[model samples]
Target: MIVRIMGEGQVELDDAHLAELNTLDDELLTAVESGDEEGFRRTLGALLDGVRRLGRPLPDATLEPSGLILPAADATLDEVRKMLHDDGLIPG
Candidate 1:
């Protein structure tokens, strides 16, 4: 899955890659918890190399609103909820 963080960056990862990285992360954390410096260093080195190869840094950017005005603070919760629900803006 490729997760794109608007105005932040993105990560493209396959299932196998994700699983491996998760395992590596877990191992590194475990080593850190156990005070195993050597193990932690090895796992961290691999993780950094993988990131250097697969990750591309995004250009700095800002997120500008789409010119949509939000409801006033004085608006009641129920009224705002109804507007969002009727507009199909809320998740079911």
Candidate 2:
């Protein structure tokens, strides 16, 4: 799988790594939904450690701007369309 970070470069992950990442994401989300703080923390920590060992930076931990200027949500549809087309993303 090719994982692309907005500001950072993309990563190519093999099947095994992708599966582990999916399992970790599922476990973390399950823990959150069940209100299991300890489980969530443990699972998150393990996920971080595992990804760190893979030598790639962790995903964005916050929603801060990536220094790339993006169109505002209220922009006209045509404007948004142009931006998406320029960015190689298409509305589905």
Write down the RMSD of all candidates, one decimal each: 15.7, 12.6
Q: What are the Cα lDDT values of the candidates?
A: 0.43, 0.46
Any residue pairs clashing in model 1, and if so which?
none
Residue pairs in collision within model 2: none
Question: Candidate 2 on 1-92: residue-level lDDT in tens?
Answer: 34433344433334456456556656655665566767766765665455445534435553433322223323333443344432122111
List candidate 1 segments past 4 Å from native.
1-16, 60-92
Q: Write the per-residue lDDT of candidate 1 for residues 1-92, one digit (tens) a residue.
A: 44333333444434445555555556655555565767756765564445334544433463333222223323333433444432222111
TM-score of each: 0.44, 0.45
Give candidate 2's error at residue 91 in angstroms: 18
Candidate 2 error regions (>4 Å): 1-16, 57-92
